[model samples]
Target: MPGFDGACTVNESVKIDHPKLVKLLQLAYSAEKAAAFAYIGHAGSVRNPDEKVAIKQIEMDEWQHRETVLSIMGQYHIPTSRYYEIKYHIIGRIISCSCYVIGWFMPYYFAGRLE
Candidate 1:
């Protein structure tokens, strides 16, 4: 758990249990789950076999990240809401469709912006 920065991380003596932290963690977990789904959809739409494989790997990584976040939330005794999960799930699908239409330009665009 080295370099873990989220709530309930091992480095801190005190655990986060605030309502706001709970809500934020829930939102972040949902977003990570959504990203994983979107990556799957993007991988499906890609023509290049290598790109598809790489995207699938990324999707798996996202799922792992989500699990880690969920575990942290669990440590805080925070419960995840099904409604928010479903809402973000639909939004993720929409993003995936949009990525298909846009030829997956978002990654490149964001990379350029970040640099």
Candidate 2:
């Protein structure tokens, strides 16, 4: 919805041998794993009961996705990203505990929590 779009055509009619495709696939899987980790980490800080439940559901989905990625990665010998930094970890913990656990007033997710 925001980034520039690019178009590329791949002709499957001809058989092509390429070594770069392996690196490309590995990078793609690495990105997927990073995304899954970010979402799972976000779910940990959800406050509302319903939101927490929804996030947990998504966490399960992320786990399954990671398993699939790992399985595919094993075949290609592609190593996954060891860690993904969650920039929101501190704010998330504060908000989740305040609004849900302790019931203290807390800012919403869409608020200026980017810091």
Candidate 3:
């Protein structure tokens, strides 16, 4: 079968065993969700209006990344791990709460380090 660009289509039946890559993508999918959740609290905690908007924008970007990761996983027929989903949700909420108590600088610092 020729692809739209006039090249032969790659065989979909050719399965490549890339456990590490799949694992990394799964981790990324959950991590993006966590980052988005954390950014919500970070935006709320900040006093500066511009900073809040930037943080919210970052949150939206994280969501977009998550969706992209999900789409890739779907293409590969990979399932989302329930353990990772639950774990990251807890971690994200914790970070969100910490953003309120730990002050503003740490959220940016941790976000920078994580990203």
Candidate with best lDDT? 3
- Per residue, candidate 2 scores C-alpha lDDT tens digits across 1-115 of 5674775565323322455754454444444444444444455556667876775676566457657766665656655543322333343344444544433223333222221
Alpha-carbon TM-score of each model against the true structure: 0.74, 0.42, 0.83
Score candidate 1 by lDDT. Answer: 0.75
Clashing pairs in 2: none
Off by over 4 Å in 3: 1-16
lDDT by residue (1-115, candidate 1, tens digit) is 7898776746543456587877888887887877876787788788999998998898898889889988888777677878879987887777667676777777434322322
Candidate 1 vs 3: which has more TM-score: 3
**lDDT tens digits by residue: candidate 3, 43-97:** 9998999999988999999899999998888777777888888888887888888
Off by over 4 Å in 2: 1-20, 79-115
Give Cα-based local distance difference scores for all models: 0.75, 0.47, 0.82
The CA root-mean-square deviation of candidate 3, after full C-alpha superposition on the true structure, stands at 3.7
* Model 2: worst 10 consecutive residues (lDDT sum): 106-115
Q: Weakest 10 consecutive residues, lDDT, candidate 3? A: 7-16
